[model samples]
Target: MPLLAGAATVVAVVGAVLALADVDSPLRGPFTLFFLLAAPSVAIAAALRGLDPFGRLLASVAGAITVDMLVAQGMLAVHRWSVRGGIAAVTALSSVLLLLVVVRRLRGRTASRRTS
Candidate 1:
């Protein structure tokens, strides 16, 4: 989760710098940061705290889509490249991280059970 947050922060900072410099960019700082952090953060929180897996997945996907839309709008405003690529990259990476966490937890559980 911290790793995801850090990555999101970096992306947000980059986006913000680009925005301030009037460079073509897909998203604003705040929105990019929020979405980048929020999706994985929420997913990890939900999973670790006993939220349903389906629910977590749904929330993450929705969050990602919302961020993608916002980024697309930002890019459109600046007449930059389409936001699709960045959005896809972020979403894919986040999903992979989320899956990894879940898998690791599950493996730990199975291992402990076997030991017991």
Candidate 2:
């Protein structure tokens, strides 16, 4: 799980940089998608870590897609459909999700330490 999160973080960073650089190439779209999806995918996977491998995979993909659609819809409704806006929104959402996971893990560790 930690490894997955790390890889997702790397992909997100690379994708964001590529998007912001305005790279005019065939890779831009795919990288942008990776940037948008990677964090959410990690977050969802982390949150569902107890599930069987196949179930976890399915849930993570569905959750990530749901998050992506919601973000895009929100942007469309508010008329803020620009590359910067999209990047910012995806980053913000991913950050929040990752933070939640980190906080939960910290709390779990602290509680275990206290019990020990």
Candidate 3:
């Protein structure tokens, strides 16, 4: 799972670079889609970390798609639909979600240590 996350992150970074550079490469479209979806998927996985493997996969995919659509609609509302905006929105939301996951995990550990 970590390997999958890492690969997705790498692809996302590459996609962001391609988008920011405004490259005319053939791979740009697919890579951009990867970038848009990858971070949210990772974040969803983090949020559902306690779930079983199959449940986690299903939840992550659904959550990622939901996040993507919300971001897209938000961009459309502001009339700023661009690759950079898409990437930024995904990255920001994912960061927040992952941060929440870390905070929750840390609090859980601290509570356990206290109880012990």
Q: Pick the TM-score winner.
A: 3
Better of 1 and 2 by TM-score: 2
Model 3 lDDT tens row, 1-116: 99986887787888878988999998888888887777788788988878999999888988899999999999999999987778788889999999999999999999999999
lDDT tens readout by residue for model 1, 25-90: 556656655655565555555455555777766666676666556756766777775444554555
Compute each candidate's TM-score over C-alphas: 0.39, 0.84, 0.87
Off by over 4 Å in 2: 1-12
In candidate 3, how many clashes are counted? 0
lDDT of 1: 0.63
lDDT of each: 0.63, 0.82, 0.86
Q: Which pairs clash in the backbone of model 2? A: none
| C-alpha-based local distance difference test score of model 2 | 0.82
For candidate 3, give the lDDT: 0.86
- Where is the poorest 10-residue window by lDDT in model 3? 33-42
